[model samples]
Target: METQLEDLRQQLDKQCLINQELQRQNKDLEQRLQEKEKLLQELQGQYHELDGPSQRPSNEPEFRKSRAAVISSEPIHETLDIAGTGVKKTVSETSLIVKAIQKNDFLSRLDDEQIAMMVDLLVAFDYSPKDEVIKEGVEGDSMYIVADGELSVTQAGRNLRTLNSGDVFGELAILYNCKRTATVKAMTNVRLWCMERQTYRTIITNKSKKKREQLMGFLKTSRTLKDLNDAQLSKIIDSMDEVKYQDKDVIVREGSEGNTFYIILKGEVLVTKNVNGHQKQIRRMGKGDHFGEQALIREVLRTATCTADGPVTCFSIDKEVFEETIPIEHLELFDDSKVLQETKAPEKSGPSSTLKFKDLLPVLYQEGRHQGDPVTLGVGGFGRVELMTTLVHGKYYAMKRVSKKHIVAKRQEEHMLFEKKILKSIQCDFIVRLHAAFKDTRYIYMVMEFCVGGEIWTKLKEVGRFDEPVAMFCTACVVEAYAYLHKKNIMYRDLKPENLMLDVRGYVKLVDFGFAKEMVRGEKTYSFVGTPEYMAPEIIKNQGHDFAVDFWSLGVLIFELLAGSPPFSSSEPQKIYAKILDGVFKYPPYLSEAAKSIISKLCRPRPGQRLGNTKNGIKDIRHHRWFSSMNWHKLRMCQLDAPTVRLIRKGPCYINFDRFPYDLAKAEEEFSGWDRNF
Candidate 1:
């Protein structure tokens, strides 16, 4: 019995030992399971980081390189597309990725999570109806996509068309640092989603250019561009730029040279031109319409000018690509009869011809009777405008000679063309007749109608202020000339006394198209290309503008003429720009209500609020009390005369004309106007 009991105890001990070993093994297995779960969680977190709802791991081989041999392979697009199948699917598809990566319109059409990601990539803008969205001839730092409402595009003084919903603008200026092509205006209260040039650069860096190219390829499948070949279409895509403008803004100006073409991806615009000396609305354009094609061809001056009818947006193309992609051969086949009627040439090139200035110099000199002399008109960074005179048959004619150095530096080719085309086409006493532009490898000569009385700038210096009659007459002439140019779809950006040449009779003859541009309706351009003192606030900010700029300039000119200085004069251009943005034109103590009213209307900050941007601006000015005794119809005929004459023995010296290698570098260091830097 004792031996049997001992055996049972030994068996129980053996069983207990076995149970303890089994429990130890089970605890070890549980610890290993927890370790596996932690590792899996870490892996999942890493995967989420790489391919989140907002971002995805690109198909770059480098990204796929790590742990490739161990993991199962899966295409990123296929995986994301499948995973995001229905809910918020639009925000996850490759198309959204492409759009988001490009910083395109993804922000405008995103789900809540996707919007949060996109909001990180945008700038916001709010505008009231008819606000100027962009200005022509100003440099731009950003592009915009409309989040809501309507816009119009304009060139010169004509309304092109209207744009609504999902439109993009301001891309061209951001892309090339070129001038704004057209003015964009809000047709209704609107909001714009903005992106800067830096943002675009970031996108390009983030998504390789090859991916961008691929995306563009996919986009070209849209119907509007279906007719074009892939190569030609790609050229257009590559050349695309963006611009924005406000209602009644002038886009392109008639008679100005342009090196840009535009595609109206969104917005409305109007086309207008001087038809038989009248501001006539010829046509209107809208989304999918393109303009400035003439620039893509031979460097012909612009024909009709355009203006924004409402807030507008557009994508612009550079001239090089625009020229290469478009069918120029088709343009040659264009029936000129459809564009312009055959007008009889004036007998003996009265004031209009395509002849060189030099060729016309000898004839005009011989017919007019005068002695040769050298005189300078302008100075400073722009160099000078020197009168190169020679006597022929007792008549002396002044040929304004601008050196190649100055011409090339200031990029005056477009300006020269503007003066030539419009001035040549019209015969107006108040308008400076631009005879011809003669180039001789080194020097550029512009044969101008001799203005022996000197610049109007000097007149303001001589007399503290002009009497009402004198001021009215001079202002009227300038207004008429400006009206004509605007009617012809041109905007003279640099409007100051320096550019206002006077004929022998002291009649104000508007001169210098150096900063002139043909505005297209419903188009925007960006270029920081104008003199600061004369620049409008919109110009300084790189917002698009139109013919309304002329009105602002006129307001400044009138104030200067009356008060002997501009209301916003300052040593700093920034200060001046700020003042302009403030939209205040301080009236002198004794100014007339009529003059004040006109200036106020003209200087309004809102392009749409300004008299000039409105269709009635011209008529409104015409009916003002200051012009109560004036005749609009007769003024249009250029029959107005100057009330006083302050003639100099000779015009100013050519020492001021655009030139270099002269004593100017030292002289400019001394003089105020000449010394100032932009």
Candidate 2:
């Protein structure tokens, strides 16, 4: 309810601001109308004062000659399709065109006689009811005025206003090579009059010195080319081509390689991305927005697909021109490979076994020596982890340093204590080993076993979605870890990809024990915690939950691995929880029935009926049909080959480890009793 209310408030504020802007424009238009009327009266008075009755009817031929002089030097063909608008007008429509032009603001500045002469250059168009007359995001070469019927103005899928007979639009397109600001749809079968770019320029250029001024004005407003030097801007101005688009055309495609960068000149377009299997609309790009420039720096695929909402237009610069014009500094983009810890042994090296906590402790703690200036590995609300090395043993480890202030404020002292104790006691090949805990004035720190492969979350995204075998390998390790923790009566209340890391050998290990709790037989805890996507129905419903919750999360993780989205995934938390309670989701056609069956049995909303929660316990999951062909013993001994692979090592900088160097190390505050048990 609070989220919905906040969203409504933001939308209301946005609409109110737009209404205020429209009010200002309406006032200015009114003031301009009054001034135009005054100017017309003054012109009439001057005509009478200068000519009087001496002006003769025979001078009509000379008057015609004066009108002809205002036309373009290079004559455009009459009775032609203007700028591919698909509608043509003949001299027969001159009077009607002139009358429509007289009602427009900027074009209305011309005298009736001048407007009549422009009839040769103007085009007439007919649109059926609901026809898109002008599309937003599309560059337009012509400006339109409603000769009859009405049109609706829309932007970003929202209707902002309406236009009736004599209302002018698309002028910005004709005035400059830019995207359409909004879509104009024919509300009724409409007759329209239009003036193309060349004709509009001739009208402005022949009358005054506004040609250079207008081009300069457009150059100033360009967002894509804003970073270019004056010389570069000048070159683009001369070489840029005029392109046009009609309604519902595709501008760019996601995942396809792109070489051109586009800046909208006119019209609105919808930006969408492939989220799971759906076309998720991300945003609407209108005037001034630049797209496809990221492709210019180096080879990369188009990140989002763009389609015309209606008719759209824009300026496109090729890679060659962009590279030359835009000065790109040589900066190395962060390689994701560096973010994971090295987990694989070198070629010819034998199989590596998981080291014991007792063996790694001495390597982590050096006598009379401290770790070097910390290079941050990662950070979150839980606190920060940094790269640390020993002086005597020359071994490396991950040191998780947490702020005491945050722990005290959130009243999580008990949770912290449980985490430290649980981590120290657990001994599983697939679980991260906690060597020792210490404290200073402002922080409590833990020295943990370093897994060269970074979080599985990072690896999962890189692969898009995992294949069944890879998913099986990763999940098997997690299942074994859960089996161990459950035997010790420690419930892993939180389970997700972010807390799982891969070692150099591509073996997975569970980390972070902040949410783990010890529970004896017939004991249940009502701790309302866990990630939204994987949180069990019982936790969300405030019902007491047990180790079954971890199994529920495992099902969600498996689904995410196979389909790239959780079965009950939703942007809204309430909707997600509702979906979870309903406990229903369609399996993709490509997903194996075996995988579906296991997830269904594990995620059963009623904990009593859920798998793993059965009397057989964790063995119910380990012995499931999905792992029927597996040798669980080999996986425990790190003998199973990973479908997606990496090998890594420990060093001053493990390239596989992520770089997030934030210095949380502050002067030690004196808090002796607060960290005595740490």
Candidate 3:
């Protein structure tokens, strides 16, 4: 009986252990089943979101850019309204502009007629993800009024800020005729309205002078020129006088005495100096540029020599003229006497006396109104001419764009800073306006006033050559712009067809300042520079010269305008140099005797013998028999009519097409690398 009882107890203990093990196993299985059910439900939700026509893109993000196209690839969907009806609206160029302007202050201020005219000029644009809207350092052609979505303003590899609807850029460059300070990139699908400089000038000129003054007042508040006023703006415009320069023409000689300033109306100029006994090129200048302001401010000798890189045009102004005409407050910015009294240099504080470009850019951009879309007219080494739009308190403006990389060489940085100085100091219609600026590590953007008619190069090429009277009239306009620049002590080095832009009314605009440099007093430069075709013999020989070189280029430009080809040329650069050294100029049979005579006087081999070599340099050129029909005083006031009327012209190149292949590739690679980082 005891053995049987012991066996039963053992069996009962084994059964109890088995029961506990089974219970634990069953609980684990139940938990796993619950987890499986949860996963299945989550997958079902994902399928519902992505399985149909409403599915979003697989690779594109929520805010990706799209091309400006007639047809869109987005998924289509039907919507049901409360009354079982649906209403839809399609996007159009006019609608896009309306949307963009409604968000901005300046464009919104325009009357219905003005707004309609602006809308008529707008073209539609769409952007893809990572598309660059504006390049840094180049003059801005257009201001973008975002219809929808977002953009980012970047500089030197840093994100400065993001811009949205109602935010306008490129106005600072347009208002000031300076280089762009930042790069703008589209962050999402963006629609923008583009306006050009020509349109804006036309609209303003059509208005009464009082209205124009009001407009000028609106532009003066920009931080870049925080101190300028309406009277000063008018004086700057009135003081403009155009002068021409040829390749290798000396603009300002080192150690020479001068009290004038210059703004580049056209072409390229090179700044060179002896560094450690070796002559080196420090910078190059292009159109809408300025130089030699130090001489204008004080009794100082020229510090550097400037020579034309090609046939160049400039607007010049003398210091005395400025003092007499410009408002006292406007003169105070560069007035040594006033600046010293208000805030002495070498001190970083006190009214922020020493101007740092970086600190001033934002204020300029913020104060100016948003202009119109950048008009597409032409492209050159300095980049594309884009139409832009601007706005102030819901009113509209027009602008142009200049690229930094296109003008400044890879090695030049300080040259760009100098260019900004020249552009910001003056305001005029003959001069391309500087509205706003932006930049990035790879490029710079200059927002400027847009001109609808395109450049003089295209016109000349289309028309072949101009008649004698027409040539004189055109030349007169160029000379006026140059007079303003030279009077300011600015040297425009390059003067070529590529740099002379024109508006609808055939008003010439000198643009590009990639090679511009500042000349302090008593400075001498000794650098070999200039394009082969238009180079002056003295510059080629490395002999020093001064502003008289501009007259030489003017002679060459006149010859070209009258005759199809430049006065001197050869098959090779070496041969061309030889011809230039020999001072060989030929007048075609078609050239008028008066025109030929003027060319001869302007192109004299000796700087002193050139038409504009004397203290009243331009006076001689103006008095030349070719200008016998012109009234100098009336011409100065733009009382004479333009020889030709310009029609809307399409840019020579397409924006969708790649102009800077290397840059585009680099930008792509950089963005891809960043994608990996993310």
- lDDT by residue for model 1 (628-673), tens: 8777676565465556564333433321122222223311111222
List runs of model 2 lying over 4 Å from the truth.
Answer: 1-373, 647-653, 664-672
Better of 1 and 2 by lDDT: 2
All models: lDDT?
A: 0.57, 0.66, 0.55
Candidate 3 lDDT score relative to the true structure = 0.55
Among all windows of 10 consecutive residues in model 1, the one with the lowest summed lDDT is: 66-75
Weakest ten-residue segment in model 3 by summed lDDT: 64-73
lDDT of 2 by residue, 1-678 (tens): 999999999999999999999999999999999888867855664685677622533311111000000000122232233333334455555556666666654455553434654665566779999899778898677887777888999999899899887677776444334467789898898988777766655443343223223333555565544555443443343334436678888889999998877777678989999999899999999876768866766788989999988777776667765444334563221222542322132323222334333333322211112333346666777588876666546566887878887676455677788888877766688999876677777778888888878877766654446788888888999999998887667888667777888877788899988778887434345444666668887665433466778889899889877775567654344455667877776777777889989999888765545677654567778889998877898988888786546533345345555555446457345453655677
Q: CA shift at 293, candidate 1, in angstroms?
A: 36
Provide the global lDDT of candidate 2 against the true structure: 0.66
Provide the TM-score for each candidate, comma-separated.
0.46, 0.45, 0.42
lDDT assessment of candidate 1: 0.57
List clash counts for every candidate, in order: 107, 38, 184
